[model samples]
Target: MAKSVNQATQAKAKADAVGQARALAPEVPARIGSTPATKFRGNPEIFGRLVEDHDKHRALLAMIEATAPNDPARKALFEEFVRDVHGHAAAEEQALWSTVMRNPETTEFARHAVGDHHKLDKLMADAAARDITSPGWLTHFATLKDEYLEHILEEETEQFLEAEKVLSEADQRYMRKVFERRKKAEKAAAVIEKKIALKPVA
Candidate 1:
């Protein structure tokens, strides 16, 4: 009876996690706005969506630490994470950073975010160098993870919010497309990784 109850609990937990993943997964038509143009005052809907992605990254990072070294699931999760994170950063760099840099009003915020990205890049490089199963892997992930959260908060509050005032309608549309395209690329990479993971090794 105890074993049966434990099995049921585990099953339910797995189901819940799957539901959450689906909820967080990136989808097409990734415009940052759903509200009417007039109502869209600051940060836009896309910024909120990006913040949600951060939450997903946090969950994925935790899962990576929990899984054993050489575990296919862990490898798969890590691959997805790296791809998605790279895409997210690339999208922002392409669309938003330049605007912030060009406009003197938000130059300080842009500089701060760029510095944050530099630190995150270092953290990512450090994490990639070590074995996923190593004792210090979680510690490494924690440091990167904390900086990432801080970066997200600062971007949303300072840069993106200010962007709503400075960027024209055309700029917003262009950026939305850039972010959407990169998200699709991230998903494609995940699919390729999954196929490779399934192949039998000699």
Candidate 2:
């Protein structure tokens, strides 16, 4: 009787240990932090989605800018869109694109993105510095719009789809989440910017 009790206790202990180990083990690759480079790297498909969403934002900006700046509501909306665009681009540059550039597989795509980034940087700076109502503002905005769409098309057709081949299913899912989160963040930033623009400056 004593021996049997000891055996049962030992078996229970072993089962509990196994359960604990399993609990501590990493889950499937679908989760955001499952891999290192995935969490920090740019997946072109995801970036393309980001661009699509951004284009919608640009459209909104153009609409609001077309209105009188004294129209508090339109002005606010425009400011919000600008803030969102700035935040999204800044985050991608800092986290995704920067890391991807280091990998040999992504080198050429990264270089192209970097060059596109330079053009975008100038466009953004020029737009931000100008009087939103200036005659040249629309032309500049239109030029930026064309370049933006072209870059996005290149990423979608060539870079992003190509990169997908190199990633695991889990990493791919993570990329989806990252892109979704970025979209949400940009939208939120736009709202906040609009709110701020509504307030009378002290």
Candidate 3:
């Protein structure tokens, strides 16, 4: 009974934190007319694709936070979140950061973004190691949420602006295609990895 009560308290605290963060976060404007085949210069559509994923992740994180510990909904949502985020980060690193890193002006930003990805990966691993019903799992997940939100904000506001200045329209268009392809591949790999991790130990 005590354990259940404690779990409920932690869940409430986490939900409250997420709520506050959402309330304070500035609205991110959608990139206008960023379609795949758009003929506009600078291929602003790549930012649109990235921002779409960011919005999805933000929603998933919020939904996951709202669920109670050990809730099946939480587990399902978390797994989906993990697959999407891991795939998105890997694809972004290969498609966007790789190009950005070639420009001296954007190189440091690329490095910093990649570093944040690693940190988030570690946080996810730590949380996955803990049973969902435990306080420790929620604690790790909370940290992950905070860090991810900050990272995306920086990428959208600072890194993307810097990258646009450095990349040509051709580069942007090419990366948009590459990001789509790589994201699909990476998400498949993530699913396979998750299955392996969950396999019963022999």
Candidate 4:
């Protein structure tokens, strides 16, 4: 409940800051730590849905960076981001990237993305060890942000395009179902892990 209130307050503060900045310059990107608005939708299509998730991840990362480490909001937001990253990576690997890998034309790109997920999982494990408010945690978070940004940019620029070119409408419809199913399973597992981790030591 408190976390929800904090999030709402923080979002309002961010919006106000952007509004003020726009009133001043009217030309620059809205404000510090703001991400671009998403152009994707809720329907779990291969490209658009993935892009939507990426946009939300970017927004959550930005919010996490903007937050003070001591704030409860920071920890809450970071946990959400972690769950999202894990679920999206797992599902994309099982569904979208696997399909892309089958096409000789996109095999290399698919492999690169899968390799990133492996490296990122390792990084996430390390980040999970640090105190939310500690300097080490912030460093880990920043590094994760950098790597995530690069991966998403690559996907936006090249990977999804390749998949679209190689995949038919029917193929995407099937892949979308698989992606949604896999994402849900992974996300549920993430929630369970979080719950178990938070339980008092026996």
Candidate 5:
């Protein structure tokens, strides 16, 4: 009976973990009012927008991973992922994390979050150095995807809450405007970069 009870508990625990992870999984935005033209007016709107970006990043990473390394399309997909991830990180740093770093208590967490971006960029660089068909490239990419998902979870659960303690209502409203504006500009720049990348070398 004890053994059976232990087995049941383990199964329940696994189910809970799966559910929590799914809550973070990429999907159609449960977050409303985030249509392409929607402008974030406050902190809650900003937070929702960030979550939507996170969802899309994860979905893209999964799609890339599913494609074999030898597939011709892999490079283009990876390039898209790079643009989105890098652009999001840059804009978030400029608009959101900068404010978070202002608070003494949140400064360390903010720095760590930024450091994760550096680490991810390095991982991407390592992957780019290899033949996409090689096992080494896939290994690097898998590690990157795993770490990227963890970073997303950390930002939502830990950094955002800590930062909010230091941000005033007015600050949040101002930051929301900045975050949305910067993200739009970043996305436009990324689209241009993607087009350039797709262009054949002369």
Candidate 6:
């Protein structure tokens, strides 16, 4: 009888602890596969998504650079970087820049940003064509890195500010959703493109 009472008391204590935890937990929105909450300036949904991708790209670039030329890790990292950038740029153009282009105040900014994406794409292609062990490939990659850094800086600072002025909070939220969906499609397309590129010429 004593052992039964002790078990009951322990069960009650465990239930109370769970209740306390639930009470203390912060309320979060119920969304499927949600990214981290935005801590950056501007609309949480819009800039937040872009910032997350930017952070990822930055880390990948650093990791790729740290690897030795001709190393398998370097090759793998570069391939991943190319796919990520391709998907991100295409999706950004479709989701964010397209909306920014609609406003006269932001049209020029969007155009310039899109142009930067094109330049980076070309640089990436040039680097990919070179022998991975050769100095030329590293040089081309370094240039691409420098240019990409500059482009994202301008984007996060200037372009985003101009875009915010023109886009309402509701619009930003909607674009975030569109960006997420389009990015997934673009990433899949990037994979297909990579596979085609790898196929031997017959």
Point to the candidate with the largest lDDT: 3
C-alpha root-mean-square deviation, each candidate: 13.6, 18.4, 14.0, 11.0, 11.9, 15.5
- Model 2: lDDT to the true structure: 0.49
Q: How far does residue 188 in candidate 1 sit from its true spot (Å)?
A: 6.6
Q: List, residue by residue over 67-92, the lDDT tens digit for candidate 3.
A: 67767767776777788888999999
Count clashing residue pairs per candidate. 1, 1, 0, 0, 0, 0
Give a tens-digit lDDT track for model 4, residues 157-181: 6677666778776777777788889
TM per prediction = 0.64, 0.55, 0.72, 0.73, 0.68, 0.73
lDDT of 5 by residue, 126-175 (tens): 66655778766777677777788888878877777677677776676677
- Model 3, 6: alpha-carbon shift in Å? 46
Cα lDDT over the full model 4: 0.66
lDDT values for all models: 0.56, 0.49, 0.67, 0.66, 0.63, 0.65
- What is the C-alpha lDDT profile of model 1 across 1-202, one tens digit per residue? 0012243443343344334443433221112212111112222345534544554565666566556665656656666676777777766666677677888888887777777765666666666666667766677667666677667666655566676677765667667777778667744653212111122121
Ranking by lDDT: 3, 4, 6, 5, 1, 2
Error of 1 at 112 (Å): 1.9
Scored against the true structure, residue 63 in model 4 reaches a CA lDDT of: 69
Candidate 2 has which clashing residue pairs, if any?
44-160
TM-score of 5: 0.68
Candidate 3 vs. true structure, TM-score: 0.72
Residue 74, model 5: lDDT of 71
Which scores higher on lDDT, 1 or 3? 3
